[model samples]
Target: METTEKSVVRRFYDIVGSGRPEDLDEICSPGLVGHAGAGSNLAELKASIGSFLEPFPDLTADVRYLVQEDDLISSWVSFTATHEADFAGVPASGRRVKFAEWDLFRIRDGKIVEITQYCDLFTIMSQIGALPTAAPA
Candidate 1:
């Protein structure tokens, strides 16, 4: 059961890395609830994924760590991409960015029902030059 849960999350990263948003419908429950920003449900989740891919078509996610307990899977992932289009009100900067995020997935009946993600938006904005970075003292 634990392995199956982890595989679902692994497949999610695979789909995202390969830029196949359509596959999400199979693994995610229609009644999905997301604790992450703007991804409150399955449709919103798919839209947010599409929105992100529009700017970073080459985005890839590497699962740095993964753990499953009960029906919940926790993953720490690293993502790399190049800014190729406008995002978050910032014009394209043509810069490569790497960021790490922690995600929690709740699985039921082999489908992802709930998701929560924690990422540092400030760091990502600074990396893409959407926000000013301070020089080291």
Candidate 2:
């Protein structure tokens, strides 16, 4: 059970990081849902991933930690990407940005059923020059 759960989670990252968003159907259930401060179903989640990838064509996620228990997997991921196109209304800065996220997934029957993600958006915005920087000491 643990191995299967872990494998499902790993495969999700592999598919997304590999820029094969079209293959998400292989890992995610038709009823898969996402709860990341907002609710999103499978279709919306796929579209969101597409939008993100559009801006960072070279985006990559490095899983720093992954733990599983009772069909639930928790992952701490660090993502790095070069800002080459407009993202969320912010124009491209041609700068590389890194951000961290802690994500939780629930899997059933070898398919991801639900996901909850917590990310450091403020830091990412600051890195992309969207947010103001701290004052120098």
Candidate 3:
């Protein structure tokens, strides 16, 4: 009878937004799949996260809202960090970037079994200089 989806969401971010990469086992399922972005499975997801944040060791996620129902949690969050390592084939630039994202997670057996996430890469890429920005006329 502990309907605490918001608390679960906070706990997840406390580990992910603050803890080291090795903490994935504490939050994600063994075969978790992110359906909205790259990184096919849990292993891939962890590796990708580690590699992406490698350059920006100080990555931080600022949560704006959390919505939950049954065993599902949805979050609206903005993450900020400086690029100091390779990310998605883009070399490090040491540029500070901030981007907002939506993440939907399905929890089962007290762990996240599946995740569907969406984020704006164009904003991040532009902020990191991986993509050219349009100039105002």
Clashes of each: 0, 0, 2
Candidate-wise lDDT, in order: 0.87, 0.85, 0.76
Q: Write the per-residue lDDT of candidate 1 for residues 1-137, one digit (tens) a residue.
A: 44989999999999888787888988999899998753789888788788889998999998998898999999999999999999899999899999998999999999999998787667779999977577678
lDDT digits (tens) for residues 3-58 of candidate 2: 98888888988887887777989999999889983148787777777777888888
Q: What is the full ranking by lDDT, best candidate first?
A: 1, 2, 3
The alpha-carbon RMSD values of the candidates against the true structure, listed in the order shown, are 2.0, 1.9, 2.6
Better of 2 and 3 by lDDT: 2
Q: Write the per-residue lDDT of candidate 3 for residues 1-137, one digit (tens) a residue.
A: 43565666666667666636568787778877777562677877677666666776887889898888888888999989888878778888888999988888888877777878788788888898877677778
The TM-score that candidate 1 achieves is 0.92
Cα-based lDDT at residue 80, candidate 3: 90
Full-model lDDT, candidate 1: 0.87
Q: How much is 4 displaced in model 1, in angstroms?
A: 0.7
Distance (Å) between predicted and true CA of 57, model 3?
1.4
